[model samples]
Target: MHDFVRTPAAVVAALVLAVAAAATPAGAAPATPRWDHFGYDAENSSFNPHETVITPATVGRLKKKWSVELRSDQSCSSYGDPIVADGRVFISDYLGISAYATGNGAKLWSHDWVGSSNSPPSMAVADGVLVAGYTDCESMSDPNSGLIGLDVRTGKELWSGATAPLIIEIVIDKGVVVTAGSDIYNDTATVAVRVSDGKEAWRKEGRRIDVTSANGTVTGRDVNGTGTVAFDVTTGATRWTVTRNLSTGTASPAGDVFYGSSGDGDDLEAVSVRDGRVLWTAPDNDGVVAVDGTRVYCSDDNGIVALDSRTGKQLWRSDLPDHGALAATVAGGVVYTAGIALDATTGRVITGTPRLSFRSIVTGGVLYDSDNGTLTAYTVNG
Candidate 1:
């Protein structure tokens, strides 16, 4: 009983387009690579596997594309590496946190805070949520620290909750936000909360547990700084614990090993994650350490050294112009440290790479460098 009417071509095309749009998933992965964590992910590997643009061949042509000024005052300085995700970049310091466009450095939205005295803020972003930590500068005697989650696209506040007295680290993984820092009583604590509702999942306190997560386990060094304990990230159940004479630094986790320094500062040791047994040790390295699939990178008083991940054999070493303590990030077959690029395999400095005052992060075909209060973006020139 339907009338036989011929539909217009334009009308038919519009109807087909609407149906296709509705079938797309709301939580699809981003089209471009993202540097979404403090060390790129919950493992704190400091290596971006998705990066493909700033390779050794193209790094020499990187030129500044845009720059933006951040809030600089007596209370705040740009604290750490810029976090990039969802087509925007986020930065946090002692004062507050802000977001900007990744392509042009345009200000998108910013949330500023007051009374953040000596405690600098920390931030982590995942699944379109940006979580930031704040301190109670008003009460220095018994200071209160907390975290706030925001909608990454619109800067909308989603949820906020209080945590330990000092939040030194924040990592988002498996839909949980894990924070590690000192508690009100000057004891180190690690707390986990759900990212969806900001509800407390579990808590571990009474030690200097510098925590990092991988798979479903959260591993951290114990109160003595020489022992490590692995816990179930969801229930805080102790999985394993081991004590050794290891140096007191944040352990960077790779697939099955935790890379750390020896107590005497003369060697780098790789400890197995399953049983906390020492795998191998490489000598003549100390300071910040980063790891990729095949090589482990470390910075010392001399310069940067690369060691085989499995056997702890030295591959190469490249000297920086001025080096004391430096941060290292690896991406696209290039090792970025102290604002310069070195070939990942050879440890040779890229000839024309610009030297930055602070450590820089490379992702999505751009180099993000922050100094004092200035944030600059560099792209490979034609």
Candidate 2:
């Protein structure tokens, strides 16, 4: 019998280790910070797919983790939603901008703007900079509004520019910052500025803009009744204009779908993101719509309706008592609206559902709720 040369145990072990190391993925490159925009993402999906810890089965045992009170006033509503990114929660109210640690709710830093006039500054973050629109409600005139860029880490003001008047709804994409004016007389005037140094890049009149899933494209609803128009984000040039119907509210863009109102005042319409083709319509008057790419959640008069994102088919519906849902957002396979939690697939309220605040969002496996003047975080359990 020929004697076989046996491999050394140490050598075999080393070979196995190398093969296992190669098979294992490099500790999945740290996930990117989420909740960067008011609608949760640039496409305004308001969906957090990475939130695996807080599931429908586990949300019933959610416990309050921490809470922090934000500054606000009676005159100005703190309607600007807080954004979470880079392990920090950034919120804006009349008192100014503040940052808190996502894990401990510890105050990181705060910055106040001079002559901000007690208005909720539209806040967003891009390229490591927190961009917000400061409105001088006391003046309400030219130069009364400006865009400010701040260092996200230290809450330091990096740049500011008086680009427009009464800036509202600050949306950032790429390097361009779009600021919609709250001018009662001119809802159509929109401006874009460079986020790096707060420089005006372009401007357009008579166009209220909405973001889309595509980059460099924004939907502009004509205030003069010309219809819903699409414009270039960089040059303010009109790409296409559909004059058949009046568009209303903030457009919810997901993939190729743009969901908004049709000015008929009773229904929400889904249009093509490419050419504004009517895809579907549903009954809705003042309900806020949030999409998760797979499903759309809306607070309608009938209650919370979950529709298939691709076909707009009603998947399920749940009725809430108050119907005063502040914001409807989806994450962790659950739908949260007006302090209630519902299963995304079945639309049934989960048991032991914690009464959240009027507005809340699930991020990093924690639910953050803004109630009265305090922001509270909750730990969910199954």
Candidate 3:
């Protein structure tokens, strides 16, 4: 947070950098190749072309171009940032997903997927087509939810189908749409769907699919059952499949191919990208929480903790808050975890305090939660 009274100039400079950084990348494939997923690339790094860490000195300087009220809907919880491609912003109003005029925020078209969402669905655009994922009310525990494709220019629904029984998330790798889901009723099967038409191109025979892909290779495993499988994205050929008894944690980092799993107790092991090898393991991580490239932040009996991405060693741990869910990201040169501030290098809680959500895309940063009723726009000071 910034003191509204002092160093207004410093605040302004920070805002400038932030505005300069908010620019998202798009490409010619969908006329919006720039946007890939959550972190704006398979790596889930959340770093855009201009996303260098913005600091406290830089936070206050930003400005709000304009805020859209997004037709007041009691049902919508806008957790994901708006995606862009071509000349429009692709977003899901609490009502449904729509393509809005990038400059004026005018509604061009929309496609609604009736799913119970905690966060907005992510988008993948390729070949002038748009693809997205949603938690299906239709398929609760199963990811056999739904995948919808829209003609980027017109709001016309090109294709919509059940790619997976429960599609927890979707990824666009090398122009193909890779989704995760496991149908419990039909046995256990994970599948990869083509983004252009909601078709199941390749699916795990009878195994549950919990894989994450980058460029094209699949990296992940089935949780609550078999570990997961590492596969070549191009041929669906298995690189490695694990039967190790463990809880499937966060899908491996898409690009680095780094995968992780939670053991019988509170333990986490980081797997290798070159080969399906256990690189390192951290002690007793009860809840293997958020996973990113630089670090893997988890919840444990010790409270929120941080581990080195490559070594799986505990870099920092702080008993900021125990038992509460933790959210984290590697930004501002620190592992910003919920309840505690794990020093980026040391993982010690130099700063430990409570915060609301969305404050900085970290756990405590939630400026206004869904319960807050109709948040028009969020205003923050560095």
Top of the candidates by lDDT:
1
lDDT of 3: 0.49
Deviating ranges (above 4 Å) for candidate 2: 1-27, 71-80, 116-118, 139-143, 182-188, 211-214, 223-225, 246-254, 283-288, 324-326
Writing each residue's lDDT as its tens digit, candidate 2 over 44-139 gives 656655565677767888998988878765554353457888889988766678899998999999887675544566667778888877666555
Residue 330, candidate 1: alpha-carbon lDDT: 77
Window of ten residues with lowest summed lDDT in model 2:
1-10
Q: Candidate 1 or 3, higher TM-score?
A: 1
lDDT by residue (tens digit), candidate 1, 263-294: 67687778776777888877777744567657
TM-score of candidate 1 relative to the true fold:
0.84
TM per candidate: 0.84, 0.84, 0.67
Model 1 residue 102 distance off true place after TM-score fit, in angstroms: 1.2
Between prediction 2 and prediction 3, the one with superior lDDT is 2
CA displacement after TM-score superposition, residue 295 of candidate 2 (Å): 1.6
Ranking the candidates on lDDT from highest down gives 1, 2, 3
Report the Cα RMSD per candidate: 12.0, 12.2, 8.4
